[model samples]
Target chain A: MLEIKNLSARIGDKEILRGVTLSVPDGEIHAIMGPNGAGKSTLSYVLSGRDGYEVTGGEAIYNGQDILALTPEARAAAGIFLAFQYPVELPGVGNANFMRTALNAVKRARGEAELDAVAFLKLARAALKKLSMQDDMLKRNVNVGFSGGEKKRNEVLQMALLQPGLAILDETDSGLDIDALKIVAEGVNALRSETFSALVITHYQRLLDYIVPDKVHVLAAGKIVRSGGPELALELEARGYAGLEAA
Target chain B: MTALPTQRLESWRYTDLRALNAMSFAEAPAASLPDGLPDIGVPRLVFVNGRFDEAASSALPFARNFAAVDEVSDLPLARINAEHAHDGVTLEIPDGVDAGVVLLVSYANGGALHPRHRVSLGAGAALTLLEVVKGDGVYWHNPVTDIVLAQGASLAHYRLQDESQEAFHLATIRATVAADAAYESFTAVMGAKLSRAEFHVELTGAKAHTHLNAAQLLGGSQHGDFTSVVRHKAPDCSSRQTVKSVLCDSARGVFQGRIEVERVAQKTDGYQMSQALLLSPTAEMDIKPELQIYADDVKCSHGATIGALDEEQVFYLRSRGIPEDTARSMLIRAFLTEALEPVTHEGAHALFEAAIETWWARK
Candidate 1:
């Protein structure tokens, strides 16, 4: 389970997340739908401990530990994964090597046996096959020359391989087409289990249609204004987030 | 002893040699052979201090004793080398002969050492020469190498400057390439407290080519400089230079690249790029790229980028569970990929890679 209590953060002087509280229990996926400038991305960055973000107050507890006190890599080892809205490009870093390094790091932190080159390649090839991605995808640099959809798919590929307990998807459906969207959604669906939970942050409701969430929350002015079932997303899509902030 | 050039000179602006001037050095004593020398299963010539060690070397037909000759040059370092140079390698390849790979190993232990090496390749000849310089304790290593490539000849020169952390290494190389010949070289600067490798290459015939690529990995208070002057003296000649520097702690890196195209050297294709990555707040890098084009129709360009590692890239790697140090290393190795791409010799490439890894481990 993940518990975020009154999370307030700021960038420099401007406050972004102001007294935000939310919760996602085990075996559940919650979607946070919000309008522009609603502090959705800031929430994800704060949870992941990115630099330049000052967390004034509040704590995020994941499975019993205050994750807000951990480093980004530490949070990742604690089973928290944030699928970036814009996957960073790493020139000259081969995808296979990157994934293997990341996987081994996480494994080492968890006191698990690290995978060798051959074992890691075998595992990565299996994940690629499941995602319907070509073998050449592993041979290229990490998102160096990838297309918009390919970058998103690469994020999902990472998510599948890492198998985090609480995966945060931050606007991952923005630049993806329908075909790529289904592939990404399937990658998430394949990892659904009793020990898995996800916080899907998106601005659109179309993605919610494929990967239906257990709960929908409207975040505006850095706070959760309304909360409801999956149908609330469809209603918001019809009515738009016009008066949700006032609610 | 010749006076060392000061910072007032244009080429020596970023590098200061006053520390070297303060120390008085004696002649190198005859030292025993150093252990753990790299062996790649090839003919090798080993030099201790400044003299050749024939017992530890393989006898090749083309290898001969070093004989110093009077050569005039305006470069102050080359002049200093010409004054005190003694034993070195002299390799001469005959026409159409593939001389394969040869190793030149120089080990110094506290002294002022100058070794002058000369290499000449006949027409259609090919040779791959790998030079490794290393030492222990405080010393001065000033070596000058002269290379001449005839028509259709090619020479792949790979150098690894792994001097001791308290040593001063100043090397000068001059090469002249004839028509249809190529002079390709790569230098890995991973040691020395203060070091500089200056190269002067001239393409004197049509379609002559040269690639001068290097990578400098410096830490602590070390200083490394890579300066090159490529003169295109004939039409249809080309030159390429890519130098990469990674500085950490209070280390400093410098790259001075100059490309000169003569009036008759039309269709000259010259390109130069210098990039540096400073890993600490105190580390510094200085780059000077000069182009003198007298030809009306030629393609020449130069670019430089010096900056710290990207924070966003760092965050991305960290979020994926990679530790901060490993993440930085991966990014740095990525930055050096382009500069190391030209090292096609398998054994040499492996050796350079191992040296880079050792440098990182030491940090």
Candidate 2:
């Protein structure tokens, strides 16, 4: 569903992603793991079309079209969702308003019927119930005073509400504890389907144990050095990136 | 001889004095009212050039008095008003009565209109006052309002200033509060070439509470200023001041707030915060906060923040499929709402929020 070839990105004077090429087929979930400077987050941002990142030499194709040429909102409407490493806290913007705007926008772009307040509340309450969160969360400001797990769950709630075709979760598992990790994994797991695909970005194999992936790729200094089955995550956790670098 | 405030004074640092020296500032004519005003089904007091029109205004069912403007202020514009004020409107609320919405409108053109007014709340009385200043041409609108709240009385004052782009506006409000009285004021500054709204509040009785919430939205070369002074003379009184401004183009915004606690005002809790959002590189904001405390046991603090639209938040919103303009509007509204949240009266809150929405739409 998504294709990237010869992706090179740079921010200012430093080059982050250099000649990285990767792809994920429809109905398959993939994982990207690497060291600190492995350009894991850069790959996600490059795919999501964030500003200030100069794509020096790369073309990202999503659903057979060049996604890099599209604006960030266009990419999102085209079914690309990026769960940021750190969610922003909008002080006075209510969660319900943000979710409604986002959901209606995506739905409108996809030629689907938009939901009004009442209809939107019903749908949102269902999703909140699935996440075991209260209805009061919708009244509060977006991510304002929310715990780390709650913020991550809010991101997932957004993803579930928007129902994007492709999701890039960057470092979503970094700060989650066991219970949070289980809920987060369950949230992603619940969305698994033939039409949906996710690019799970993480540093450890802990998340892989819950939300098993079809394929795992080792990203080093911006390039995909190795591609293997789920066992690659366990192997990397055991021997570290040094084992892969030596190979 | 008491000296009128001028550019030489520290309080009028950024505003120019030469401009005021040039204007004739003659008493303006009684121009007609505007075509549209909010339909809140309340008593309306309409004024033209500071003169009350008995034929146009509704019959006064309650109590009212019109006297010569006499009280003088150290501010230059207040002095000007004292020297030449046209008429005044005083609405005194009786005990335990909840006066709905009182709409006060002032219209002017090519002149200085000084309207002095007073609002005295009886014990346990409540009121919501909507004061609107709007007009055209090159006029100077100077208004003074005195508010006194009796024991356990409460008042919600909403001030909406939408003057001509070529006009000048200067207004001052001095208020006193009794024991357990609640005073909440919200001002939305949207128009005027040069405008200043000064609020001086004194908590005279113990356990009184006061909230001064204001929002200023200016674009182009417009200038808006909100200067306030809050004094606590009684014990256990609390005061909160939140002022937010959004300046675009070369618009300039100024916020000066001061809080003073006397020795008898122990356990006084005062908090003041001023924030500005500059949408353009040339937009300027000057914020000054002061706290004077003779009570060692009092708790008082003030803070100020000035910044441009956060790029990260913008990007995050856009990444979620919201357009840039919508994202900007959301952030600006959020910024303003943070300061406007304290407005309790539904009518005044909606009016203030509507003014903000209109400013956002125009900008």
Q: What is candidate 1's local distance difference test score? A: 0.93
Quality of candidate 1's docking, in CAPRI categories?
high
For model 2, residues B276-344, the per-residue Cα lDDT tens digits are 999999999999898999998988989999999898898888889887787899899899886776676
For model 1, report DockQ. Answer: 0.87
Shift in Å, residue A66, candidate 1: 1.6
TM-score of each prediction = 0.97, 0.95
lDDT of 2 by residue, A1-247 (tens): 9988999999998899989888898888999999999899989898988888999997889999999998888899999999988999998899999999988877787788999999999999999999888899899999999999989988988988888889999999988888888888888999899999999999999999998999999998878999999999999999899856545
Q: Tell me how each candidate scores on DockQ against the true complex.
A: 0.87, 0.76
Q: What is the DockQ of the complex in model 2?
A: 0.76
Report clash pairs, candidate 2: none
lDDT of 1 by residue, B240-289 (tens): 99999999999999999999999999999999999999999999999999
Off by more than 4 A, model 2:
A243-247, B1-4, B53-56, B63-65
